[model samples]
Target chain A: MTSSPEIAMPAADPKDPYAMPALMPSSADRAIRSFDYADFDIPTRKQEDFRYTPVERVEEFFQPFASSDDVTATVGMIDGSALPDTVTVRTASKEETGVPAVGEPADRIEAIEWAAAPSELVIDIRADTPTPVLVDVSGHGLDLAALHIVIVARPHVRADVVIEHTGSARLAEGVEVTAMQGSELSVTSVQEWNDDSKHVGGHRLRIGAEATLRHSVVTLGGDVVRLRMDQDFDGPHAKSDMLGIYFVGAGKHYEHRTMVVHNHPECMSRVIYKGALSGEHAHSTWVGNALIEPTAPGTDSYELNRNLVLTKGAIADSEPNLEIENGNIVGAGHASSVGRFDEEQLFYMESRGVPERQARKLVVHGFFKELVDQVGIPQIDDRIMATLDARLDESVAAPIAEKADDGTANNNENYAHNQEEN
Target chain B: MSTLEIKDLRASVETKEGRKQILNGVNLTIESNTTHAIMGPNGSGKSTLAYTLAGHPKYQVDGGEVLLDGQNLLEMTPDERARAGLFLAMQYPVEVPGVSMTNFLRTAVTAVQGKAPSIRTWTKELSEAMERLRMDPKFAQRSVNEGFSGGEKKRAEVLQLELLRPKFAILDETDSGLDVDALRIVSEGVNRAKENTGMGIMMVTHYTRILKYIKPDVVHVFAHGQVVETGGPELADVLEEEGYDKYLPEGTTESALA
Candidate 1:
């Protein structure tokens, strides 16, 4: 299968300085067409939403849509290296059938599996089980990649899943997840890719009735990252909480878009997205849309988007849309904001003997703690924190490396380490 | 050198017109293994004195020297002061969302100790501290001060003081908002720390209920940003019985306490 050419359209147009391209449809009734990378579309300054995140840069760095199995293999290879160390590896052959290493969630657990497009992995967690699972995938140079997962919790099961990105430095991936009825699933996805990767991944979750799902995503890497999460509530009385926190550095562009559909009556959904942008040319985009149908009465939904601009040259965009056709629902609302770190909090932390960088780290960590804490699994939580630490290191390290190139490299390492100490 | 010594600490707050004096000219010294009670009516600069010692920016110390033992407390940043064995239990502790009390305490303890304690030791210490304060262990996992009752907040401050083991602590109105039972529990936690360590303490309060549990060796009555009267525990009883009316300036009246 090939992506539609329209997918390649530049998010911004160079020739049209005044006009922006129209946004992709916001309604559920809109057509779903194949996306191709070859046909590039660009947005113009005229568009308020795309004013900050120019898709043109993505077009310049990436090639026009081309069917390259190399890219797919690249992504597949990424999955191989970063697979959860403790996953229940069930190979199709009998030799691979020993208990698929589903380590205890509260303990050390990592899961990663690769299968044919039609294959599925089942993770059955028992009731009241607070296990943590870590999953990893990387498609550094792959073109098209797709992975499917089916998590089955016998009634009243609860567990946490942590997914990490390592080698898949630049590739597109499609992921699918389905949770059975009465299962509580908490999933945390941490993306810490190299600056060279152009990453695109989609996560679709189909939740069963009376099941609870908590999803937290942390994005801190990749040059061009476009991630979309779609959640559908099929069972009545089911609840879902989705949180996303992202930090973008200079010359980096990241986008996180989400669509949640409340299909059943008396269902609930909450989405919180926070981002920080720094550096001279960092860019971030967030588009959130929630659809509440007429039949799904008594549904409660809330969406909030908050952004912090760490530097003047940085850019941030936020778009939140709530479309409710009928008035029978209990409550539905959405809020969005873009701001910088509270100077008061920063000054307070700084005055406390926390050097500037350490204070910044603390504030940023506190910002994301909202989502990170939802992942009930300690193993996943620890890994996510480690990823954040690495990204912060990378952010501070890259500049030092550049300075070192201009001077002495040894001194550069010391300077970088010293800066981190600050 | 005492745990804390303040020399001519003059501080003020900025207003729309100009700077308004908060602490006119105050001087105090507290030795280790002793507790000093600084009691006064509202707005008498009791809290200001605590915040100034902790290096709060709002209260500019126009003239003063705050020394923690021999080191210049004013020269050290708030955190440096903390690491050097200074602690302040605020009258209103700030709510830090998403950061658990356990995580916060662990980091603070490690920072103060210059190394991380073993998880076994740390967790045991945490449980014991919580038990001493009569706090639910679940509170350790909750966001700092988020959704906590008034009494819970006060207890948390004492819990932190126990875990951090600072050489000197300023409990700013720790008894202001607590019920009788809460006050007793908090006082017991503080008393235990006092018994275990040679740390000195400056307790700022308007009420005398807590004094019954944690006896103070000295009492200073603060008025007009200065220690108007320094006496023994008897001063607390007299202030509660007679009120500060007789001490007020000529033009001031009862409502001036506001």
Candidate 2:
């Protein structure tokens, strides 16, 4: 075990014996939530949630405006089949949607979106699903758009849902999920938007007794994309696995934040997020917050965030915060890392006759293999890998080609020497 | 037959103190099908020579010319050197996470051969090679060298050597951490590769125990970054009995022996 530096504590004041201690609030407790747009102020860098984000790029989504009708969402099966009888998709007013709000909007953008969203798209699953539900969301132009989706998994129902985003738009979106008792539900949200687009999303989940929820987020394209996920346990013996994968290219920013609250006994949660950045001004950030409440016992929770920086001008920030009020709980831990490619690993592969390009690709693929496998959709998995490979090749090949040109010029003298020996 | 020639090779490594020369004007030549043992004490540049031959970025070549069959090996990149029929079985093989042994080996073979091997033949060949080395078949599915035992790592290195079939192979202290049984198993794998491909071998080690199993046709005693003595297999026996003390400079301190 590694030893950590000791933290100095402030001495208690003797003047006021009954004075409450000035303790810093937990991240979850510090977050502000509201359902009304007027209740939220415009976010800035001063806010902890917006500290790492390029707030100016997504400011358009922060204001209350009528959503553009250009945005459209279509629901279909992953295998191109008709919707099964067990599942139904319909639009309803927010007040009459039948599914209670898991949590209020956590930020200005979400609040603005909640107020402007015309209606909620509801997908209700009553039984086991034969195929994954795919929702393709597209924006036609650079206009402001809002989306709200509610996914309900009835008792003992098992289903998979996918939300795919594409096209150019300044968008604000909210996704709410409720896994009823004994149900197993998996949801994946993929953002592959146009390079000129910006997006802000808030995803809220409530897990019921003995229910399981697998939530994944994959962000690949966009000038700026920030997603916030909040998970709360509503009953005992619930399990939540949150996974995220992202790749930020040149002049792009992608940020993901997750908050898991354990309010029931025998609850388990695992958060794993991995990302890679390349090229000038490529940046990515991950912030994971896990809170184990005093009322919760026998809770098993851990969060991990890892980032790989593939170029000189790229940057990655990873932060993991855990707040445990019940020491008697099973366990709670968090770990994070932001680093570049391992030179030794590269050398090992190159020594085995793998070219530098291929070696780097293999290393990156290996780095993300575990988390990508957790996505569990072969088509999406393959798409993510291919996109990663193409981006890596473009970013890695340019510098090597330039270096090779320089090498040829510098080694001209060496070539003459070789000719002499030959 | 192919020949690997090292002429007046001088190299240095950056230490905390500054640039320190490791291989000072070293010279040697080995022909295909020959097994040459390079015996040296710790810090005597045995591993440096191996890594330099394989183009490790840590060791900078100050002045040298390494010719493999009249082609300058020093001018080629590490991967190019491998494709040019050279291999190095590192002492501490790297643990590459998430890259399965099967994937790594297949990619390597494809790069070296300039073509991807047929799936049917490649799978059969890989399993056959693993079986010969007494390696569990599951290792093919596991990440390359990750969570492998010391003995397993060494066997994996030789497994690559047998499969890659390069013109020359450098074993950098391949027997250091192996037991008697593991050493023999690893040695047999090396011998089988030599017999099948007639590939030359440059085995670097500090001890002579491995010589008993994989007999060296020639032995060179290295000290102070240079080859001080060269002889036949009998030289290994002499070093085994006397140790590297006689090879050190006069009055060299014990700490400097390493």
Candidate 3:
């Protein structure tokens, strides 16, 4: 547990070094990505951010007029609060554009999003109240699309949000979250894109004085997806808890890079992410970086990443980095591990008369159980489990025991691809 | 009578010191519906026999033939042998995390019996078996042998023996780590298994205490990895009073407890 600071909160500085910088379009990103989207060099493998990802894949979404002509993503409230919706969740108005979340786009593709998207959407939850919001994006066919969302949780309020992406489309999106003082906010972002969908997004959350934020990212289905989660502490005693769970199947790539910047005194952060990969050419990468600034005294933060490999061909590259600029800080640590399924566990099951294949499936199922349960949403958790089971079934899809015409064999093909729409 | 014959059985284990011969040219026969008590001192290969018969990967059988009815037990995998009606109550039962006892037993019963047990009948059978073994009903849903006490592990082993209903059951030190009350309860489960299913049992123990609860038709005194003495039920009483010193070689360091 992170303790609250006993010292008084630092007064707002007249010349706040961390204050908003006045600049050209180069100012805000999560949208800052490409002030010069025109000259934004196609990031090669040399770029640290695009090294693990196939850098060439961004060309499809970079073309102008990428917004879907027919498909319209909608936002719905599922929590049944009956609070009679207050803020404007979404509007097609082109004139409703607002401020971008934070600093300039840290990567090239994010710069592409600024050059693409058609309409601008800003979601503002009235200060000092609780609200639940869900973002549903459904795509059809091959087309370029972009979404930019800015969410503000005013002081003393709690906000819970869920963002889901599905269907076939190339998506470049940016999300910025402003958590005001004494506010509590939790956002669960799920990416269940189709087999051909490609997506990349920059999600940045900035915490205010004495505020807390809980952020979770779950990536299950996608051809190529990368999510960069960036967190900044604006005032003292702000805390952040981050969690993630992902599964990558054959011919798919998923990468999650997260950074927690502790710039205020007495701020704390913790991150835990677990992922699994299966099938040939399955690839997943996780990078966690924690940096404590010089003036940030009494700061404590730690991050951990674990990858479970189910098949020989699958690959997971994990890197956890911790940089404490201020030695006066309390503590900072990070850990990353990649492991294969335990063969001894399988043998124990087989010794009890379970066939080898079934035993293997059981061991993998148990491997992901604890993390899946932590996602906290029963509906989404069940879907993720079903998807994971379908993914594992592909490896053992070979016929068992010569059962002919076996409707069971077809049932084992892995997925129904039930596209959820309401 | 159904005979499970062991002919010229020879086995060795890979110890840190290299392959050490444990069961060398030992032979025994078990007929259905009878209990055979095999008493041996420590390091006499009693536990090795149980593991070898159950197809554990550790012990290597150099030259042997174990025949159950007309099938060869030595040729079958552990799971195959289990499906062919063999049960081993291990000295140290393994812990299988995330596999509940109810699920594990149900799967084994389905594989062995070639069909899933009816739900109501399985529930009744499982509850009755647990009650007879004095195990809490909650234990049925717990991961197999995980976090169980010594006595609880022993009872769980007996519970499997009752439900699996194998043709030949090997009780390997089932009496070892158990209190008197637990010993009686476990023995009662074994007795019920024999009475209801007519299953043959090979009871291996260093003490004669288990024999007091579940009477044996015959008792064999084991020494040097082979049976050196055999007699009727009275032999157990004799060994309990006199020990196995007469059967062991002179200057043998192992205590003659059997």
* TM-scores, one per candidate: 0.72, 0.93, 0.75
DockQ (model 2, Cα): 0.69
Docking class of 2: medium
**Interface C-alpha root-mean-square deviation of candidate 1:** 3.1
Indicate the residue-level lDDT of B237 in model 2: 78
> Residue-wise lDDT of candidate 3 within B135-242, one digit each (tens)?
899998888788999999989888888888889999998988888898888888899999989999999988888898989998998878888888999998888777
User: How much TM-score does chain B earn in each model?
Assistant: 0.95, 0.97, 0.96
TM-score of 1: 0.72
Go through the candidates in order and give each one's C-alpha lDDT: 0.68, 0.87, 0.76
Interface root-mean-square deviation for each candidate? 3.1, 0.5, 2.2
Worst 10 residues of 2 chain A by lDDT: A413-422
Which pairs clash (backbone N, Cα, C closer than 3 Å) in model 2?
A: B42-B258
Span of 10 residues, lowest total lDDT, candidate 1 chain A? A413-422
Encode model 3's per-residue lDDT on A260-291: one tens digit a residue: 88889999898889887777678898888777
lDDT (10s digit) by residue, model 2, range A1-422? 44455955554565653463444454556677899877777889998788998888888887788988868999989888999999999999999998788889988888998998899999999999958999989978877889999999998999999999999877888999999998999999999998998888899999999999999999988889999999998899999999999999989999999999999999999999988888878888889888888778888898888777777677787777777777767778776776667778888888989998899899998988878899887768888888778877877876742221222111111101010100
Sort the predicted structures by lDDT, highest score first.
2, 3, 1
The alpha-carbon deviation from the true structure for residue A173 of candidate 3, after best TM-score superposition, in angstroms, is 3.1
Tens digits of lDDT, candidate 1, B1-258: 356789999999989989999998888999999889998877788898998888876778789888776798888767788888888888777776666778777777777788889999899989988987889999998887889999999899888888878788889988877888998999989988887887899999877777888888899988889999999988778777777776677766442121
Backbone clash pairs in model 3 (N, Cα, C under 3 Å; residues 3+ apart or in different chains), count: 7
Per-residue lDDT of candidate 1, residues A1-422 (tens digit)? 67688687545454663365233333555523233322222334454334444556543223323223333221111223443322343313312422232211110000111211223344445445433554556554644333444444445666666666765444444444555678877767777777777665566676778988887778878777877677887688888888998888888888887878888888899888888777767878888878887667878888877776655566677777677755777777777766665544544444333444665566667777656666455555666676666666655454422211221111111101010000
